[model samples]
Target chain A: MSGIRVENLVKVWGAFRALDDVSFETGDSEFVALLGPSGCGKSTTLRLIAGLEFATSGRISIAGRDVTGLASSKRNLSMVFQSYALFPHMTVAGNIVFGLSVRGVSKAEQRERLARVVDLLGLSQLLDRRPSELSGGQQQRVALGRALIAETPVCLLDEPLSNLDAQLRSEMRNEIRSLQQRLGIAMVFVTHDQTEAMSMADRIILMRAGKVEQSGLPHEFYERPATTFAARFIGTPPMNVLDLAPGADGLVIEGGAGPAVLPAGSIPLQLGLRPEQVTFASAGQPAVVETTEYFGADTITACRIGRQRLMVRAPGRPGLKAGDAVHLAWETSVQHFFHKESGLRCEIDPAAPAKKTRVAETTPQ
Target chain B: MKASRNALYGGLLLLPAAVLLWTFTYQPIVTTFIDSLYSTPRGRRPAAFIGFDQYETMFADPVFWKAMLNNFIYAFATIPLSMAMALAMALLVNSKLRGQAAVRMAYFTPTILPMVAVANIWLFFYAPDYGLVDRVLQLFGLGGQNFLGQPDTALAALIVITIWKEAGFFMIFYLAALQQISPTLMEAASLEGASFWQTLRRVTIPLLMPTTLFISVNAVIGAFRLVDHIVVMTKGAPDNATTLLLFYIYQVGFGYWDTGYAAALTMVLLVILAVIALVQFGYVDKRIHYR
Candidate 1:
C-alpha cells in the first residue's frame, strides 16, 4: 500500500480557480473522504491527485515519488467514476479483467485475478452478463470490481454512491468501507453527502469554494469545526448559525435580548449550534416553539429564540406543537463561535462560559 | 356500432399514407416485376410472356457480368475504406483542437456540394497535362498521366472520388455517435492503463458497432444505386470499366430503350438489396449492443 501527498495544489480554469492552494495527505490504508457541497473543489482535488488533470501549479507525490507530471496510468491509481463508466459492450468478466489485459498480464494470472475479484465482489454469477443487464447496484459492484482488480496502491472514487438508491447506498457504504479495510489500500473518495463522509471516512476533509475549510477526524468536524461552513456542512439538519449582537455584558443574541454567550468584542461574532445537540430544558433560555417534525426515532423541534431559529433534536414523540412556550438548552461544550465577517472559528473567551441569564418569556404566536 | 365507426375513422386516417406508398413505391415495384416476365411491346405486336429468358440472357451477357463485377468492387472497396475514413475524421474533429468547427466544415463540404458538381470538378482534376493532379505529378517529374482514359485507373479514379464525396456524409453520422458516448468511459479506460489504440479497439469500436451496421447497410445500397459520378466523370469509357449496376440499368433502359431487360436488371438489384437487408439485420444486428 502507498500514501498520497498533495502540496499547494492550485488549478485554475482560465478565469475560475477550481482548486486554490489545497494541500492534504493520506496515510497508507487510511480511508479519507473529500466532503463538500457542489462546486466546492472536492472533486477537483481528487482529480488533480489522480493525475486525470494537471494542476495549474502544484506538486503531487504518490508513494514518495513526485508524480505531478505523470499520466494517470503511470501513477498506478484506479478510479471509479460517478457514472460507473463500465464498457457497455463488455461482460462483467471482461470489465473486471480489462486493466490486466491492457497491461498485457499473463493469461493465467489474468484468469486467477479475475476469479479472485469476482469472488471478492460476489460477481461470480454476473460474470457473463453485460453492463446493461445488471441492476444499478450490480453495475456499481462491477465498477468496484474493475477498480479493485487493478490492485493499485491508491483508489479514487468520485461520488460512487450518488447513483444508488437510499437502501443500497447505505449497504454499499458499509460494503465499500469494509472492502477498503480488508484490502488495506489507501482510499480517497469524494462526496457531497456528509452522512457518507462522517460514517465512512477515517478522516473527513471539508472543502468550500475551492479551499479546504477543515480536515480532521470525523468527530472533529462535529466537535470543533474550524469554520462556520464546516460546522454547517458536517451534521444532519446542519448546525444552525446565528448572528450575534453586542450586549452590555458581552456579545448577546443578535436580534433579541438574550444571555450574553461570549465576552464583548468589537469584532462581530456568530454562534453554531447542532440540531441534535439542543434539547428542551425547563430552566433554560426561554424561546417559542415554531414547528415540530416527527421522525420515527426522534422529534425535531424548531425553536425561535430572539430572531434566530435552531432545531432541537429529542428522542421519540416529544409531543411538542407550534405556538407552544419552550426553553431550549445545550451543554456549554457544544457551543461553536465564529467571526461573523470572516466565518472563521474564533475564541471569544474560553473562561467565560455562555452562562444563562434569566430572561423574559416571549408571547407564543 | 362504436367499434365499427372507430375502425372506419382509423382506416380513413391511414388512407392518405397508404395511397401514397402504394402509388410511389409498391405499384412501381409490382409493375417492374410484371414487366420483367415479358418481352417489350412493339409498334404492332403486343407483349408476349417469356419465363426466365431475360434473366438467362442477362446472366450470359458479358457487359452485365462486368457491371456486376464493377459494382461489387465499388461496394466492397468503398464501404470499408470510407467508413474507416469517416470514423477517423469523426475522431479527429471530436478531439479538443483549435479551429475544430472549420476542420469539421471542411470535411463535410464535399457532402454538401452536389455530386454532379463534385464530379465535374474532379473531371478537370483527372484531365491530361493541365489538370490539378497532373500538375502536381509534374512537380515530381511524373506527368502526362491519363487517369480516367485508362481502363486500369478509370474505375479506381472514380472510386477515389466517390469515397471522397461519400465519406464526409457518413462522417456526420459517426460524429453524432461519437458525441453520444460518455467521456467518462474514456477516462476510465485511461485509468485502467489502456493506451489510446487499446481503448479505441476494446471500448470505442465495440460500442460503435451499431452505427457501423447502419452505415454499412446504407453504404451497400449506395454503392449499387450510385451512377452520378460514373455519369459525370467516366461514363463507363475505356472498355466499360466503370459501369455500375444502376448505371448499366440506366443505359439499357434509357440509351438502348430495352425496357424489358432493364426491368429484369432492376429486379436483380431489388433482390440483391433485399437479401443484403435480411442478412445484415439477421446476422449482424443480433451481435450489436444497441445501448
Candidate 2:
C-alpha cells in the first residue's frame, strides 16, 4: 500500500541544479526506472526518494503521509547501493538480520526472516562467509537480500547491475524484476543504460540536464520521441538527424551527395530516422558507404552523403564496400520532425495550418 | 650477471647504514648485557664477573617488586584510557563539524609538546596548594586534598596526565583508519534502516579494530618506555606510589648506583614490551583476512 509522491522536488548543489522542480508519483507496487545519461538527476532523484539525500525544496509523501523531514531509518525504505556496500565484518546471515536486530526484533523472528531471505536469494551455503569471499554477482544478491529482509514498502536501487559483467547484468536484471514483483514493493531504480530501463521498468522516466524529458511506457518513448536529445539517446546506432530546408516543391534534405525530397506528411523542418527505419532504396538520396558493421542478424551501413553521415540497419548481412554508392530513404510515418533552432518536435496534423508555433517537448526526440 | 651487479650496487649503497647500525644499535645491547653481569665502581679496579647474585638480590628486594607491580598497573590503566580517548577524538575529528581542523590541531598539540615540558606544566596544575586544579576544586567546595603529595591519589593523578598527554598521538592512527572507510557503506547502512549509533557500532567500530589493536600495543609499550614524566614530577615519591619500571631502573643504576639490579629490571621491561609487540602483530595478521 506504499505509493510515493514527489512534489516540486529541487536539488541545488551550490550553483548547479541537479533536480529542478521535478515531480512524479508512483502507485502501489509500481516499478519505476529513472533513466538518463550521466548528470541527468536520475540518481539524485532516487537518493532523495530513499532519504539518502534531502531535497532543497520539495514535499515528499509516502503512503499518503508526508515524509519530507524524515530520516532514512524512520522512513522505512531500503536501498541497494551500486557498489554493493555489504557490511564487511558480518557474514551473509548476519548482514541480512542487521536491520531486524536494530529494530529490536526477537532472536527467533530475526532467524526466521534471515532464513526466508537467504533461501530466496540461494545464499544457504554462503551464510557463514563474509562479503569479500563472494563473487560480484553473489555480493549483489547478498546486498539485495539485506534490503529484502527489512521488508520495507519502497526499495531504491542505484545502478545495482552496473557493476556486473554483461551476461550477469542481464541475468540479475531479470532476477531483480521477478523479486520486486514477488514482493509487491514500490521500487525506484536508477540507471544510465536505456536497455535496462526498457526491459525492467513498468514506467521509464527519461531525464536530461536537471529535468524530466518524458516518462511513460518504453514503446511510447521510442515510437514518438518528444525532444531531439531524447531521439538521439534512446537507441543504438541511434536515430539519424538530417538538416531539412523548405524548397519550392517540398522539404528537401540540405546536405547529402544528392538532395532528397522528404516523403509527403513529413514536416518542413529537421527530420530524424532511426537506423532500423532507414533503408537503402534505388530512388532516394545518393550516399557513399563509409563503413559497414556486420552484426549477424543485421548489418549497419554508415553512409556519408556530403558532410552528413546516415546509419542504415539493413535487414540481412551487407556486403557493401567503403566506396560503394547507395540510396537511402524512410517511410513518412517513421520519420520525426523537429524545429531547426529549438529542436522541438513539429506536429504533423493535417487539420492545422501549414506551419504552427508554440510547440511542446516530449522525450526520445 | 646483471642481477648480481645490481645486488652488488645495492649492497655497496647500504654499507654505510649497515656499519652505523652495527656500531650504534648492536654494540650497545651487547655491551649492556656484558656490563650487567660485571661488578665495577667509579673509583675502583677493572670490572670482574659476578654472575647471578645481582639478579637474585634484585628479586628479593620488595621495593623493586613494588615498583614492578606499580609499573604494570600504570601501563594497563593509562593504555586503555588513552586508547578510548583517542578513539573518541578520532570520531569527533572525522565528523562534518565546523572548525574541525582547529579541533584536530588542539587534540594533536599535546603529542608535539616534549614530555619534560608537559610534566613541568602539569606539575604546576597538580600542585597541592596554589595549583589550578585545587583552585578550581575549591570554587566548587572540594579543595584541600594534596594530589601529588598523597600516596593514594598521586599515581592516579600521574595516570590522568599521561593519558591526557598521549591520547592525541594514538588518535592520528584512528583518524587515518576512519578516513579510509568508504562513506558509501555508511549511506547504505542508513538506507537499510540503521540508526546512527547502529551504524557506528556495526559498521564504523568493526572497521576501526586494526587501528585500535595497533594503538593499544603501542600505548602499552609507551607506558613502559616513557616513565620520564613520573621521574621528573613524582620521583617515585610518597612511598613509591607512582614508581614505574623504567624510573625504577633509572633510580637503581644512576641514583642508587646499582647497575646489576637495574639491568634485571630492564630485562623485565623488555619482556613486557616484547609481549605487546607479539600480540599486536598477531592481531594485525588476523585482521588482514577481513580487510
Candidate 3:
C-alpha cells in the first residue's frame, strides 16, 4: 500500500514534450533513484509524481490510491527539494513543525513530533536559529527533518546532496540511506550522478530524452545495460562502445586486425567494455597509450584501439606514458554487444566465440 | 600630492549637485525656519522679531487641527487598503500564463498617469447622479448624492481615489519582491498542506515584510507630500473635510498671503513625516527579513 506506481506519464509544456511515456514503480520501503543527465526528464518525472506538475496523459498512484489528479498535499508524500527549500524566516523548530501546524495538529502532538525530529537530526540546539544562520548541511538536515516529521509513507528527494561539498555529500549519503532503512519508508530520489544512484539506490531508473532507457536493480544496470546509452551512462569514464565491422572471419573492431570477436551480420554492431574491466596485459589486443591521468589510488589511461580510443582503469600509477605501446585485456566472456544504429543490446552466445583471446574495445561514436 | 589632486577633482565633480541641494533644499528649510520666527509686516505694523509666534498660531488654528485629523484618517484608510490590494494584485500576476505581460501593464497603467489627470477623471466618476459610481449605485437604489460635494463622503471619496491610484504604484514593488521569493518556498508550503490563506499569512506575508515596510514608509510620506489631487478635485470643500496638511499649507500660504504661518505649517508637516519614517525604519525594520 505504501509503494508508488506511475504509468505512461507524458508532460507537454506547450509544444515541447518534457516527459514521454515514462513509467516506473517502487515496492514498499524500496529505495529507487531516477538517474539521468539534466533535461533527461528525471526531475520532470519526480515533479509529476509529487503532483507539482500535472501530466499530459498518465496515471500516478501512491499508497494504492489513484493520485493522478490529486494535489501534492492530498497525495500523502513528502519531498526534499534540491535547494532544500527551507523557510528563511522560520526557526528550525518552526520549519520542522510547519506541516503539523498546517494540518492543525494539537500543540502537544506538534511538540512531540518536533522533539522526535529535532533529536533525530540533532537540531535541538539550533531550534531557535533561522535558516539563513544555519550551514548548508544543517539546512539540509532541517529539510530532512521537515520531510520526516510528517510521518508520510513515502519520501522523495530531488538531487538533495548536489549543493554540498564532496566530503559532506558522501557523509549525508550514508546518513540518508541509514535513516531510510531505519524508518522503513519508501524513498525515491533523483540524481544525475551514477555514483550516488549506484551507492544509495536499491534500484535505478535511468532516463534519456524523456524516456526510461533502463530500469532495474543497481547491479543489473552495471552488469547488463539495455542500450549503448545506458552502458555509457552507468560507468565512470563511461563504457567503451566500439564500432564492429565485418571481418575476414566474423565481426572485428572496425578498421583493426582481428581474430574476429563476433559472428558476422549485415547490420553493423558495437562492443561495450567497462574501463575497469579492460586491463593492461602481456599478450592481448595491442593499443597505443595516448594519455594517462593519475588519481592516487588508480589511474585512467586512454589508449587507441584501431580507429577508436578506449579508456582503461589501472590500479595505482601504471607508469604508462603517452605514445607507449601496450596490450589491453579483459575476460572474453565479459564483452557486451549492441546494435550500431539502434543502440539496442544484442545477445551473442558466450560459448561461440570467433576467437578465444581477450580483446579491448573502441569508442562507438 | 596625487591623493590631494584626486580629492580636489572629486569635489569639483560633486559641486553641481551640492550647489543645487543647498540652494533649493537645505537653504529653503533654514530660510523657512528663519521666516517662521519673524512677523511679516502689514500696512500699519513694521516687521518685528517674533520667535515661535507663528508656531503658536499654528497650534491654535482649528482648521489646522481639522486638516491634521482628516489627513490621519485618510492615511489610516488608504495605506492598508492599498497595500493589501497591491499584494493581491501582485500575487495574481505572479503566476505565468498567456498575456501575463498585458495584465501586468494594465495594472501598472494607473501608476504612470498624472495624478492631476487622474483626479479630473475621478471627478466625473464622483459626479452627483450621472457619474459612473452614482449610476452603478443608482441601479442598486442608492444614488443621486454628490460624493465629493458632501462633507461625509468627500474625504472617503478622496481616499478611494488615492487607493485606486496608489495600489498600482505599491504593486510594482510587491511584484518585484514576490519575484525575488523563490518558487520552491511556496511549493514547500503547499506540500505541508497549507491552504492558500494559511500560506499567505505564514510564508508570503512574512517573506514580504521588508517590501511592505518600504511601501508603507513611502505611503506615509506620500500621504503628507501629495496634494495635487486635492487641488484638482475637492479643494477642501464642504467645511474642510478633505483638507490635508499640505493642501491647508498651500491655501494659507498662497490664498491668505501668510507666508510666515505657512512656513511654520511646513515645518510641522516635515516633522510629522520624519517621525513616521523614523518609527517605521527603526521599529518595523528590525522585524522584517531583508533577504
Candidate number with greatest lDDT: 3
Model 1 lDDT, residue B173, Cα = 93
Question: Comparing candidate 1 with candidate 3, which one achieves the higher DockQ?
Answer: 1
Worst 10 residues of 3 chain B by lDDT: B282-291
Cα misplacement distance, residue B10 of candidate 2 (Å):
7.1
Ranking 2 against 3 by TM-score, winner: 3
Residue B90's lDDT in candidate 1: 97
Clashing pairs in 2: A225-A364, A226-A362, A226-A363, A227-A365, A230-A364, A231-A364, A231-A365
Model 1's CAPRI class? medium
**lDDT tens string, model 1, A1-365?**
38888899999998999999898887888999999999999989988888789999989999899999999999988999999999989999999999999899999999999899989989999899999999999999999999999998899999999999999999999999999999998889999999999999999888899988898999989888899888888777889898988876777677655556676777888988898887776645667889988888998888887778878888998888998988676666678889888899986443455444322122121
TM-score of chain A of 1: 0.94
**Compared with the true structure, what per-residue lDDT tens digits does model 2 show for residues A1-365?**
69889899999999999999888888889888898999999999988887888999999999888988988878888889999888898888888888888788999999898889998899999999999899999999999998899898888899999999999999999999999999999888999998898889888888888898887788877888887877887888778888876544345666643433443434447778799988776656678999999998899999987778889999787679999988775665677878777777776642243323211111011
Better of 2 and 3 by lDDT: 3
- Better model by TM-score, 1 or 3? 1
Predicted candidate 2 versus true structure: per-residue lDDT over B110-159, tens digit per residue:
99999999999999998866899999999999988789989899999999
Cα RMSD (Å) between model 2 and the true structure? 4.4
What are the TM values for chain B, all candidates? 0.96, 0.91, 0.93
Give the number of the best model, judged by TM-score: 1
DockQ of candidate 1 is: 0.80
Steric clash count of candidate 2: 7
